[model samples]
Target: MSQTVDRALSILPLLAQGPADLGQVAERLGVHKSTALRLLRTLHEHGLVYRQQDQRYRLGARLFALAQEAVENLDVREIAHPHLVELNQNCGHTVHLAVYEENEVLYIDKVESRYPVRMYSRIGKPVAITVAAVAKLLLADLSEAERRSVADKLDYPMYTPRSTPGAAAFLKELAAVREQGWATDLGGHEESINCVGAPIRGADGRVVAAMSVSAPNVVVTAEELLTLLPLVRRTADTISREYSGSNRPKKV
Candidate 1:
């Protein structure tokens, strides 16, 4: 990286905890006051950082503008939101949209269950890398070698009585998921809470993410979930159309 860019980038974390003065930034970065000043000036000029008369520095509006652009560029959540709401209303169950990120499943969006009894999971929560129906969908997207490697390295904790136990079991379940294009958590992650998930394939034929509908086991049977399979897949396909990956080259 260029010296100026690297110097400017190094100060971003400090700005995250609110703002900082020149001396404090210089001290944290282990640079002379003059060097820090020069870097800050350049950053301010480029709108990457901002400075106040109180001598404190924080991230600038340019960064926020860039963040807005990035968010606008991401169409997955936009497309999924309406479908998820519909799914929730129709099934009277909670619905979630989860994407793969750094080996974990990140909940990007979700809808609450309409039923009186239900399990609750939050958006932005990072679930375990090895478990969960949505996580399994991500694993299905990996190449065989990558899948094996990830399975080998994972902790594979037992979240509940029905949770898959080891790498071998996980592999078997993943195979089923690939074959069926869906996965199930039969009260796996949390006993008595069942979930059914289907992979959302991009135009590239890659599994981009998974959408799930979850509810109390007693109220929603696996058979009932299976009955809703076609709707769930349709919803996923509709949203995948708006996903960025849909524009990429597909496998078939």
Candidate 2:
């Protein structure tokens, strides 16, 4: 890869974490000051990045536009959208599409139910890896050491009474999720909200994303969640095949 291109790509996550000045950016990326400046200039010209008045840098509008287009054109979503609609209508619950990125689960798409009492999950919002059922679904794909590294990096805040309390506790829950091939969040992220999620595997047979159904605890009991497992798992499996092509054996 071109030096400038590599630098620009590396800078994206640093900018996404927050904004940063040239010196800070260079420090984090382990490049010299001169190289960072040249890379930033090139990226700015391409509209992939931009600078603020105070001299801090951020992802530019062009990158956002590209990401929006990519999200709209994602093959997996194109194929799974009709299925998501069916799942939402049949289950009468809010169905969300989430992909694992870095140490967090990012919600990329959702179909909300018409019910008055519903969880308001928005696209582009990120939640802790230890708090959401979707996170657990993705976590199951990681090796034990990989999971521990991720758990350590995570904040693991107790958003609700059911949220995992610490890294060790979270790892135990992850172990169970791995064994079960599904995950449940019972009022963990929000009070009275319950979610059940299953991992979406790619043709590489690696877990790439999660498909989840969220409902109020009163409206969808634990038993109801269990009943919905097959639907969630099957939808995820379909997405995996469509996106990844063929199933490769999953490694633990």
Candidate 3:
């Protein structure tokens, strides 16, 4: 609906065909040359567009990076779904796969517990960024500056007495999670819910996504949940290996 956004988005597909000069972009957008230049400058600043030696604009390296990330996320979900199911089958607990995107962490896949007792959650739902185990694992991998930035912006709602109290505490928790290479939410998001989570790393050893196994206190004590950390980490490692192509069968 916004003309600036519409024009900026139009430039991407236009440039996708090939590089385009300022005059060409202006003509295609039906806007003044200065207007097109301003739009291109905005896009360039965001690394979505590049100005070449010929003074023509083309898709920037960040575009390819974003595209690759999208592809990797799709592959992660595809590769991790069966693993999640298997973990749920073995443990009879709810399994969740989540990724951080646009400053929000959302569940991309979930396997319900086989047991009649189950946790309530939905795929595509944004997680409790400050308290969820998967959210912690994902955010913990971010740079210290980024972590502080995000933590400063979040509301530390006391979902439970165990919930992280504020930015300082959340940042501290993230540090511990990053150092330990796994995280947990014990009565953090909900009074009765507890979760243990591990990071799924990419080929470069960056956290690409996180997966968790969750159960309620009524079903499993905190100590019982802690006992499953090894299993959860193993499952997360398996997903990471497969997603990174490290688990590919060796040639016979």
lDDT of 2: 0.83
Ranking by lDDT: 3, 2, 1
- Compose the digit string of candidate 1's lDDT tens values, residues 154-202: 8877888678899999988888888888887877788887777888777
Error of 1 at 36 (Å): 15
Candidate closest to the true structure, highest lDDT? 3
Give the lowest summed-lDDT range of ten residues in model 2.
243-252
> Which model scores highest in TM-score?
2
Question: RMSD in angstroms, all models?
Answer: 4.7, 4.5, 10.4
State how far residue 110 of model 2 sits from its true place (Å): 1.3
Residue pairs in clash, model 3: none
Candidate 2 Cα errors over 4 Å, as ranges: 1-60, 244-252
- lDDT for every model? 0.81, 0.83, 0.92
Tens digits of lDDT, candidate 2, 1-252:
696677768998888888899999899989998888888898888898888898899989898888789788766566677888889988889998888777777887889886888787777778566778988888878988889899888787888878888899989999998998889888888888888888887766678778889889778687777799898989888787777664354664
Estimate the TM-score of every prediction.
0.70, 0.74, 0.71
Per-residue error at 239 for model 2, in Å? Answer: 2.8
Question: In what order do the candidates fall by TM-score, top score first?
Answer: 2, 3, 1
